[model samples]
Target: MTIDGISSTQGEDGVQEFDVLIIGAGPAGLAAGIYARRAGLSCLILEKGVPGGQVLTSPMIENYPGFPEVPGMKLMDHMAEHARRYVDIREGEEIVRVKGGERFEVSSGAGKYFSRALILTTGSTHRKLGVKGEDGMTGRGVSYCATCDGFFYKTREAIVVGGGNTALTDALYLHSIGCKVSIVHRRDSLRADKHLQESVAERKIPVLFDTVVEEIVGADEVTAVKLRNMKTGVVETKPVNGVFVAVGEVPSNQLA
Candidate 1:
């Protein structure tokens, strides 16, 4: 797959052009590849991480119709294979920046990939709790998707951090699945919608207001969280099994 005397080299400045360069290899990018190939255009998919993107982080998804329920990783694997049948799928190629024009040029870790059309499907990253062990053991124990890691913490206690809709939603879902959900927020007031607040209050979810997580305590897995009260300036620690960070999500639109 050498192009224009570039010798398929890495860190080269030469541009290798294609009819289409998809910036992600997720479901969206895979779908685009199917259509682009059917349209008889050369397509290339550049993905930074694993080919599945964030979808690989999900557990069992039941909402997607046609199948009763399917494993997220399985679905993504099938998609990647199907898309590869039509388009050239390149994984682990970090696209640093995109220069848009008549022929968009994508600068990657390898080299430049020029395309007549560019599909920006670079998704988002999960928000962090900034706590001690939280960042240290991201993939090991602390998780964003409950469905993915809930089974690992079955019958154990978990803490959800946030005062917004996402936090409340996570609490409700965890509570429904029989995990003791503790809602920890920094502010005394909740920024969630009124209806969502009502749901949280109605569910009798234990909420620690005006308090924030000072640090996540754990060795191999998250075992507890150190808490700090903003108003009283008191610090305390609560033993828990896991920490579900629901602060927010940051979209990966830097390449947009």
Candidate 2:
């Protein structure tokens, strides 16, 4: 069948062919599909999940050029819609294996596809705390993105585990939203920019230095976290309703 006026033919072996195959449907992948179609190349986008990638988890975005403020889901929806008008997008297709050659061969659970060129736009995954009860408490009270989960903790208590920009920013956001926030860093000092550190201090946010979370404690939901002081070797269980682990991110390049 023809998609977006680009001929997508299934060969006798049931392999769909395209000029360019994009392995993700995030901002970069969507943009690449649009550009490829505009250049008169037949393109296909294979996404394992829904479009939008990690941006979908963001609650509010103010840094985007045109709109003063927009929801992450809304912004990604607009981009995906625009891309659909130009290229063929196949969502829910996770690429399982890829073989390189004069023409790349890509395989998914459904079938195989061939493309002269391949674009890998896979994004990143959030790093986890790896502490006890963290996996079981996920979605019950554990979250990786503060902007995504901070709304649930307003007027409640939450702890951000990290000293980087993302962690400090999350703490500031939680505070602004009326959540009693604290910072738990394994290091003595924060690694965030000076401005963000100043903002945290200006807001008088409490930061626990040289501290690490040993375990997340809860029955159904998160009730507290077991913290260990590196210098003094003292262990304490701090009561909290939410645990926002923003240590860092690892690239989602397994398919590549």
Candidate 3:
């Protein structure tokens, strides 16, 4: 077969060839693309989702090398744009299977391509609570991102899960925007940095120790959450319009 009446001779195997194939479009993948392109290698980046990855969902980033307190999406955009100048990137293309051999054959739904060197920068996915009403009320009221769903909770009360850096940061952001936010932690102490811990105390944000989110309660939107005391086995219901799950992330190392 041929396109535009021309022969399609991608060898007999029908796989496109490339010197390097980078999977993912996050910071690591983009950086790899830049290096490969600068080395004068035929490189291609296959991104299953958006180009910027999790950076797009970050609210604010303060400690990135040069920039001070820049928006996450803005920072990721710049990184993606900088890589685009030298590398060829294909967004919305997922590398479903990777065949190892003398050369790696990358297969996706769109097509198949072979590369001498394969680099996987598949970042990570947010871990879910798997509680009742969570999967059903994802976008409606329950969310995993503060930067993406914080604005919608203006002047409303919100509940933040976990006690890590992400959870603390999200709580502070929510409080800043007129939302009365509370932290529910399964541990007595937070796993965040000391500075953040001090800030949380300074901000007077309530943290329920040994507390776990049992269920996300709401109808059309999130109205409250059912929390259980891990130590005493006492269950309490708190009114909240938003719930941000910042528990942790599951690495995308399946291809690796």
Output the number of the lDDT-best candidate: 2
Clashes of each: 0, 0, 0
lDDT of 2 at 166: 81
Cα deviation in Å at residue 58, candidate 2?
2.3
Best candidate per TM-score, number? 3
Please tell me which model should have the higher TM-score, number 2 or number 3.
Answer: 3
Task: List TM-scores for all candidates, in order.
Answer: 0.68, 0.87, 0.90
Ranking by TM-score: 3, 2, 1
lDDT of 2 at 69: 87
Q: What overall lDDT goes with each candidate model?
A: 0.80, 0.92, 0.87
Q: Model 1 clash pairs?
A: none
Clashing pairs in 3: none
lDDT of 2: 0.92
**Cα lDDT, model 1, residue 225:** 83
Residues 180-218, model 2: lDDT tens digits: 999999999999989889999999999999999999999
lDDT of 3 by residue, 68-156 (tens): 88988899999999998877678889889999998888888999988789999999999999899898898888989987889999898
| Runs in model 2 lying further than 4 Å from the true structure | none
